[model samples]
Target: MAFFGFKDIDKLSEVDMAIYRYIVDHDEQVPYMRVRDLATGAHASNSSVMRFIHKIGYSSFPEFKVSFQTENQDLKNSNDDILTMFTRDAFPNDIEKTIKLVAHLMLDADNIIFIGMGASGAIAEYASRQAASLGFNCYAMKDPYYPLVQQLHNTSNNVLVTLSVSGKTIELVEMLNNFVNSADTVLTSITGNIESPIARIGRYALSYNVEETRIHKYYDLTSQVPAVYLVDGLLKELHNQDVARRIN
Candidate 1:
């Protein structure tokens, strides 16, 4: 379910994540495939595939396949109520802590940039408006190609909040990669898959687990409600902290 609940998900390179996602998404076909076949399917070199396999704690390809199959055997398909997918306890332990920490980052930030593509872009826009209403300098970049310098504040801390259901969206990932090394910018990501590439790169990563669904195999119908909740949660926490500081 989570790359077999792998402990070193944070260590996976982007290429390794591609292979991991490919295998998970095409679970039925992977157990029978050779290393070369997996490389072809995941659009990576055989060496990359092997690296990922070993990273997940397998000594050999066959051993990895056997473990993967055992882990996936209990996976069952089910339709989930999008509304109830997130509950009070939905936040994982790490995310619960990150939410508290990120609130401080937002409170101190000179700029808060919300980035996303497609459906997530809509949510990013919504979050920006909400954050702006709280008097934070926030901008939503719906288009991945938008020049960040247009609204960037170079004099102070900048927080980049990325929203994605599948954290593997190429455009968003590439954009994050460009800013990953900036000392003035802080990276935060809200994704359905906490182990996704974007999540791994974020200084703060929050995740809400939900079954990924698609219509016509092209349109991702993954629920954005959890993402909305996380945005509101972060904003609410930020508000509380700001109010407390004012009162103090």
Candidate 2:
């Protein structure tokens, strides 16, 4: 039921709802069932069915099947038994603050790098592309295996923008715990926990306000989109600043 609240959400359509239900209902059976069987049984077409699975959180139908069957194999577990807090209305303040801090960081930084994994990784990639387009020294590292701690320990100049909805990503935490208080390096974190290891260690922290819906594991973004919104706003702010400097 982790993805339940999202089932009938305006954000997701009927087919999406059906697909999620099917996954949950046949949690054990899905891993052995063929896509053709799922499509036929679910009364959905195979192509669209496959796409929907990926959209919900699976990389492919096979992965989705394995994840479904292996729910018992999860390493980390959630504490909240009943969903709460994050919904589509997680508040706008978190995102808004992200915009302001990011712009300021860019104006002050020699370079910027955004790092993340999972949905946060997607966000980092989005921000990196935007920053690069604006001519900022921004990169979103795909090397999740390498400890960001070692990288931060060796690098100089600029800023590091990291994303973690839970604010508990291990590699990222390593980086923050290692560097945060030692040198006055700039770090901006977008996460759910204001007091998480990474956020606590950051020079500036932006928490994505998430509302826990009845059935979804992810919190609603009233707090999260701010990181993305901040990237857009920072670009605009820099544009205005450049124009003003030229006029002056």
Q: TM-score: which candidate is best?
A: 1
lDDT tens readout by residue for model 1, 21-95: 999889999989999999999999999999888778788999888878776775533324424666766668676
**What are the runs in model 1 whose C-alpha is more than 4 Å off?**
1-83, 149-155
Please give the lDDT score for candidate 2: 0.67
Between which residue pairs do clashes occur in model 1?
none
The clash count for each model shown is: 0, 11
**C-alpha local distance difference test of each model:** 0.86, 0.67
Instruction: Specify the poorest-scoring 10-residue window by lDDT in model 1.
Output: 74-83
Error of 1 at 41 (Å): 65
